[model samples]
Target: MISKKAIQIFSVGIIAPLTLQSCQQNAVTNSGDADTLTGRLVITGSSTVAPLVSEIGKQFEGENPNVRIDVQTGGSSRGISDVRNGIADIGMVSRGITPEDDDLSFHSIAQDGVGIIIHQDNPVDSLSDEQVKQIFTGEISNWQEVGGEDAPITVVNKAEGRSTLELFLDYFALSNSQIKPSVVIGDNQQGIKTVEGNLFAIGYVSIGTAEFSVSNNVPIKLLPLNGVMANGDNVANGSFPLSRPLNLVTNGEEDLLTQAFINYSQSAEVHDLIKKQDFVPLSR
Candidate 1:
C-alpha cells in the first residue's frame, strides 16, 4: 500500500500536467494578501517544462500561502515570447537560450534528455546518429534498412514552437523543412502514444516523459543514441549527448514574487519533485 505522502507526490509530482498540452490562454488568480508575498504569476511556455514548474508552484504555494501561479504551455517558443513581450512572469523553456534571446535571464531548474522511442516489440534496440538523421529527413523510409521489420517507417515529429523539437533539430543539425513526418504531435505524451500505437512509428521525446510512461506499462522503448542510453542517470552524469537544460527565464529585472518563486524552484525541497517528473535535479 502507498502512503498518503507517496500518493500525493504521484498526484502532483508525476501526473498532473506532465502529459498535457496547454491552450493558447493566460490564467490569472490571486492567493494570500497584497501585504504579504502575494501576487499573480502567469507562467507560459514549453509543455515539457510546464509540469515540473507546475509541481514547484504547488509546493511553493503550500509554503508561501500567498502566491498563485498560473501555468500555461504552447511550446518553448511561447515561453520565450511571453517573457520578451511582458505577458508572463516567467517562461518555462527546456533548451538553452541562444544569443537571439538576450533580453531575458536564464535560470536552469533541471536537466533532461531527448530519447528516440519506438514500439516495445520493434526489436531494434538502438540507432546511430546518422541513421536517426536520415530516418527523420525522409532519406530512409523502411524499418528493414535499420535492422527492423519490413514495415515502412512512420515518422512522428514534434510540432513547431516546441523546444524539444528545436533542440532535436539543432543537435542533428537539421532544419524543419528538411524533414517529413507522417504525424505531428504537440507534447511528449502525444508523441509517445503515437509511437506506442504504431509498431512502425518512431519519435523523439523527453526521456523523463518516456520513462514515466514506461513505468506505467506503456508499450514503448527508448532507442539509444550513438551507443548511449537516454536515461536521467546518464544525462545527470553528462554522458548523455542529447541532454538539454530545463530553464525558467525571467526579465533581467523581476518582481519580488517572481524572484521568490525562482529561488524556490531551485531549492533542495523541489529536487524530489524534479525527480518525480523524471528529470535530473541540479547537484545538491
Candidate 2:
C-alpha cells in the first residue's frame, strides 16, 4: 500500500543554519526584459536528490522566466567536488555534511533511507541483519542458504563515490573490499533495474526511490530491514534505521541566483515537489 504519512522531515546533523529567506533586494538584477528574473544556475550531484531538485527548479523557472536551471547527477562525492572546485553553482548531497566538510555550506531539503531490494519473485521475505552482512561479504553465496530458491545470489553493489555505498558499508560494518559484487551500479534506478532484470539479484537503494518505483508497478520488492517495514512512513517517522539527509551544497557565499535557487528549494513551496519524488521534505 502507498504510504499516507506526510513526507516532511526535519534535517539532522546540519553543519550550518540555512538562510531560508531570499535576498531579492541584495541580488543583482539581470539585464533582461526588466520585469522577470534572468540568470543561469548549474546544480550537480547525487542521483537520489537530482529528480526532486529538478522538479523544484522547473517551478522556479516558471516563476522567473529567463532563469535557467541545469541539474546533473553523478554521486554525492561528485556534488561535493564540483561545488568545491567552483564548477557547479550548487551541489546535491544525499548524506549529511560533517565537520570535516566545514568548507562547504549544507542546505537540507529532504530526508531518505537506504533499503535492501530484490526481485519481486524472490521467495525470501526477510533476512537477519547478520545474514544480510554475510551475504554481501560472500559468506552466504546461495539463495538456498537464506530460505529461498536454490540459486547463487547475484549481489548488486553501488559504485564508489556514491553516498548510498558509503552508508551501506558503515551500517553493515564493512569496507568496499569486503563485498563480492556481481555488478556495480551508479544510481538508484540502475540498481533497481539490475535487481528487476535478475530474479536472484539483491541490491539497495533509497527507500523513497524504491517506494516510488514500486508504486509505478516496478517488478522489485523492498525487503524489510531487520523487523521494520521499509517504506516512506518509516523513513519520515525515523523508525527506519538507515535514513540520510538530502542536501543542497554551496562552496562559499553564493551569487544571487544560486542563493535564490537554494532558498526556494528548501522553502515550504517545494514540499509537494519533494513528496512527489517520495522524499521527506524539510519541516516548517
Candidate 3:
C-alpha cells in the first residue's frame, strides 16, 4: 500500500513535464516566422511627411526586430525622383506626382492641410483666397494694407523643390510665373521659425509643423483660406481648398516588406497615429 505522500509526488512529477512541454510549444508558436523578415527599407520624401513616416518606421521595426527602415527628408520632388530612379524603396510626398512620374506607383496614405500662418501678435484673423493669392504673389506688401499693424509684410516660402511651394503656386494660379525672387526660401522647419520670430512674417506649412509652432509658443496663428478654417474636419469634408493627399510611392511590384508597410499604414492601429502626427488618415 502506497502512502498519500508518495501518490502526491507521483502526480506532481507527471504534471510538471506536461506543463513544461506546453510552455515550450507556446514559445515556439509565438516566435513563428518572426525572424524570417530581414532587410533594409529606404524611405525618402517630403519633410512634411517625414515625422509621420518616422513614427511608423519606429513602431514597425519594434515588432519586426530583423528589419531596418531608413527615413530621409528631401523635398517631395526629390522623393518622387528617388523612387523613380530606384534610390529608395519608399517615397513620401505631400502632393501627387504627374504623368511624368509614370514609372513610379503611388499610394495615398494621408491628407494634409496647408495653412497660411502669421505671428500670433498680428491681429489679422482671416484672408480670402484672393487675398492669400495676392499676398504670396507679392502683390500685397504691407501688413496694414491687410488690416494688421503698420509693418511691411515679409513672405516666407519653401525652397524651389518643396511640395508646399508647388501647392501654393498651383492654388493661386501662379504656376506660369516664378515665385517672387524676394520671397524668403527656407525648409519646412526654417519657414516655421522665420514666421515665429518675425512679427510681420507670413508663411505656409503643413498642419503638423504649424501645431509644433503653437506648442513651442511661437506666437503664430493659422489663417483661414477662402473664409474656411483649415482643420481636420474641414479638410476631410473638402471645405478647405488647400488640403491635399499625401502619398507613399514605390515601384508597384509588391514585396513582402513593402506590403507589410502598406498593411501597417492602412491598419486601424495606425489611424490615430496619423492623426496625432497632425495629418488625416486616408481611410477616413
Mark the 10 consecutive residues where model 1 has the least summed lDDT.
1-10
Q: Give residue 122's lDDT in candidate 2 (0 to 100).
A: 96
lDDT by residue (tens digit), candidate 1, 1-284 = 21222111123322334322232232333445544676557787788888898878888878867556777777788777767777777888999979998878999999999999999999898889999999999999999999999989999998887888888999999999988999988888789989989999999999999999999999999988888888989999999999899999987877677777898898898999999999999975
TM-score of each: 0.87, 0.87, 0.84
Which sections of candidate 2 miss by over 4 Å?
A: 1-36
lDDT of 2 by residue, 1-284 (tens): 11112111112222112222222223446675555566666676788998888788878888887676667667788778877766677889999877778999999999999999999999999988899999999999999999999999999999888899999998989999999999987888889999989999999999998998999999999888879999888889989898899999987788767878888888999999888998887776
True-vs-predicted CA distance for residue 111, candidate 3, Å: 0.9
lDDT of 3 by residue, 109-131 (tens): 88888888888989999887778
Q: How many residue pairs of model 1 clash at the backbone?
A: 0
Sliding window of 10 residues with minimal summed lDDT for model 2: 1-10
Error of 3 at 107 (Å): 0.9
